[model samples]
Target chain A: QNSDASNEPHTVKKSVLATYYHRKFEGRRTSSGAKYRAKKLTAAHRTLPFGTMITVTNPDNGKSVKVKVNDRGPFSRKLAIDLSESAAKEIGIYSKGVAKVKLSYTLE
Target chain B: QNSDASNEPHTVKKSVLATYYHRKFEGRRTSSGAKYRAKKLTAAHRTLPFGTMITVTNPDNGKSVKVKVNDRGPFSRKLAIDLSESAAKEIGIYSKGVAKVKLSYTLE
Candidate 1:
């Protein structure tokens, strides 16, 4: 009985197509009702609840960033999450427009 | 200057010992005068200025988190940055209490 294991958060991991928000989206209200700021570390998921935090990683470069889910996005079923401009840049994919990333989220 | 390169943000990178805020600091006012909330992705740095955002990565685990510099100090010269609870958790160092992390910040 490893009690600490149960006490710790449970994680659900997935591989997804990552894209970033455009500057135009700045000042727009997100699904969570928060204004989307290009420089904030935030993201959008199809169905994750507001305030859910996810660790997104570009495995190729081992670059990762934790982003808060504050909107619903990517709209295309093929894409998983839409990262904020700053979040994407941190993972070295802002200029690329898109990339494959590993998403790790905890159930809290 | 390559026009695009000049227009792009510049990065400042460093390796630091990362510690996280304790639950007791849940409602305390940070140096930036904002109440510290453990669930929010935020961090404290000695001199990066308020509102600066940093991408912190645990290289060993390839996990990272983007946190805003909303507070000040670990107070110890040997320590570099103080991350929030959720941020630390995202990087798999919540229970560890401390770890070495690579910090990347963009100068816009």
Candidate 2:
């Protein structure tokens, strides 16, 4: 749960070691203990403020997905944000397991 | 908090005495205790199963808003559902304070 993303607006956008969650975690709750649906534009971060919106871009595919930080963890110093399955697929990163992503913060 | 809805699919559609929460309730938690944003498509119910999807229709304007049951109630026997302020306004019922609405269920 690294919260290094929000030091400032300048620091908010960076390359992240990102990965998607497995199916077993779907029905479990995180911050609200609310279940996460793979289809929802939501995600988990070590800590960038829950509900913070992050637009993740995959430079390889030139695809992007804007997701809300609703849950927590990738549980590593190297791993930054954990995207939902659909969010990961939105940028063509699901099968790769882990990918470098451009993450930027937004209020909505 | 009348739950006259959901006896069956045939009974899922009915007119309900609906009202919305005041602005003061925005930061408070109901079921999850998660703060609510007025713009989210969410609402409270007496008991229709949490996360249940409800489509509320305002017959006067022929407008409808689809909301998910996330919070819990108006706490009155006569009032059936409590929409969020935005959801109330979406169907043009915010000004009325209270109104009769046709409620329907959907899986999403």
Highest lDDT among the candidates is held by which one?
1
Cα TM-score per model: 0.33, 0.32
Clashing pairs in 1: A66-B65
Residue range A1-108, candidate 1, lDDT tens digits: 113445545556555444555556768766566887766777665435557766665444565677777765543423333333344445554455445554432111
What tens-digit string does per-residue lDDT give for candidate 2 at A13-90?
Answer: 555444455555556555446676655666555324565666555444445555666654433434433333333344
Q: Per-residue alpha-carbon lDDT of model 2 for B1-108, expressed as tens digits?
A: 335454443334555444454555556555545566554656555435566666555454444556666654434334433333333344444456545544322111
lDDT of model 2 at residue A24?
56
What CAPRI-style quality would you assign to candidate 1?
A: incorrect
Error of 2 at A86 (Å): 42
Q: Give fnat of each prediction, in order.
A: 0.01, 0.00
Count backbone overlaps in model 2.
3
